[model samples]
Target: MPTTINPLRYPGAKRQLVPYISKLLTNNNLAGSTFIEPYAGSAVVGLELLQKGLIKKLVLVEKDVLIYCFWKCVFYHTEDLCKKIEDTLINVDTWIAMKPLRDIINPNDWDILELGFAGLFFNRTNFSGILRANPIGGIKQASKYKIDCRFNKPILISLIKRLSHLRDKVEINWDDAISFMNKAKKDFIREQCFVYFDPPYFGKGEKLYRHFYLSSDHRVLANFVRQNKHFDWLISYDDDPYICGLYSGIGAKYCPFYLDYTVSSGKRSKGKELLISNLPLPPVDLSMTSSQY
Candidate 1:
């Protein structure tokens, strides 16, 4: 529980793309729109959108109970959580060196600070930060040895900055994304809502965090989006030929981007990953600087 949640450590999070998203928003003059994230894992994009003052209202949904609970604490009991985290961090440097999983996996450690840090720790250190129950399913270790937090003043400050500029208009829900999207699509107007999907990769084998997603579920969602042509959406997925084929007949265009991989135990190993987004595949002829604005 944090008064303010940090944007870091979201598994498969898009915090790094804040600039790109902001640029797109600026270019499109998209403000005051209701930002909807159906599969909001840790809500990096939503949080960043709020921080930048781009969106007026946020509809963020996550299926996980722990993550949902963590956000609940942050929204309702931030001050107390901040105080507890501060008290626990004897020194900034020493605290940063501690692994996030050490507390999350341990049932006995349920302090607000531990919960808050656990969310972050799992995201940055776990395999895809997918939040699977088993630690062995993770792609990497939290750390080989703890780093001293005394010198990690910057880390402390960064977390504090994120905690300060929280949005008041955020709506958090714990529900299956596909079901939520279907209902949300029907209940809300088409033009005002925009969805950003970060579903699990297809054919990636059994996941350490298998509970978070399934290929069959993804198929259902993909079909829903494909059928719901009236809605505006941006779907991101691994660069698969089938994905390209699936959206080929649809109006959705593919844009390729890279996501750095921290976990190497699986097929992806350690390298920048290729992601295909059904969003506007930026004008091929335009320069990065021109399109950036």
Candidate 2:
């Protein structure tokens, strides 16, 4: 497990992949390049790279307004967000109060501060940091772990304050992933940019992600990656035949690798994940991965 810098705990977090990504960046002469993450969730990967000087800057794109507000608050309204974290109660009662934010049909219609605070509160308490899921100890508060298990005020506040200093080094955008890519292609210098796409899971996207892609939506993304293969781009997905075939059809280089995945129940389980990229990536495990050729 790599050092966790961000305050937000995320489901299927790729923070552990930082070492592999860092090595790839160095190997491709992309070190100190401007890194772009289209479907930035917690953005643990990009954050780690920037902090380590592996990337000079980062561009994070997220469509979920609540999530966007969280990043916006972290970057722009640092003291206010830190104060919110400092003075808040992390009991079951407060957790219940925060649950209503999830029911919000259109988060953009709500107050940015309210959504930002609620997102941070819910993410800290929720199992595996899944916004739609229940808190760690469950609603009954019977589990030994309890709701406040992941919310440490001093630690989170410190993390927030530290990250706020890098505001100029990051650009947060509230837009669809592919839409942002289309615009970024012209905006950022292609030679100095490295793009990483961590889209929703293939089979369980609808359940795991609030803004997941439909099959057609996924195809649209694949086509975009295919057309823009000239750019340094990498895409990650849960190991599935359909997802593997989708990129393979577009002549993308792909490989499957094993990683330990922690579930909502707080149990770590090993699973296979796939990475498809336009840039060169040798398979970590030859027996588990098949090339397009």
TM-score of each: 0.70, 0.91
Per-structure clash totals for the candidates: 8, 0
Root-mean-square deviation per candidate: 6.8, 4.9
* Residue 5, candidate 1: C-alpha displacement in angstroms: 8.1
Predicted candidate 2 versus true structure: per-residue lDDT over 27-61, tens digit per residue:
88999889999998889899989999899999999
Candidate 2 to truth, TM: 0.91
Tens-place lDDT digits, model 1, residues 1-293 = 33233534433334555566656555655666777888776577767687678877778887654565466556656665456445554322433454443434332346644565455434433334445432322223344422221213345445544544463788888777888877777666645666677676654524534344555576687688778865466676667776666666666666666654434343333223233344554532212211000
| TM-score of model 1 vs. true structure | 0.70
The residue-level lDDT of candidate 2 at 52 comes to 91
Q: How accurate is candidate 1 locally (lDDT)?
A: 0.55
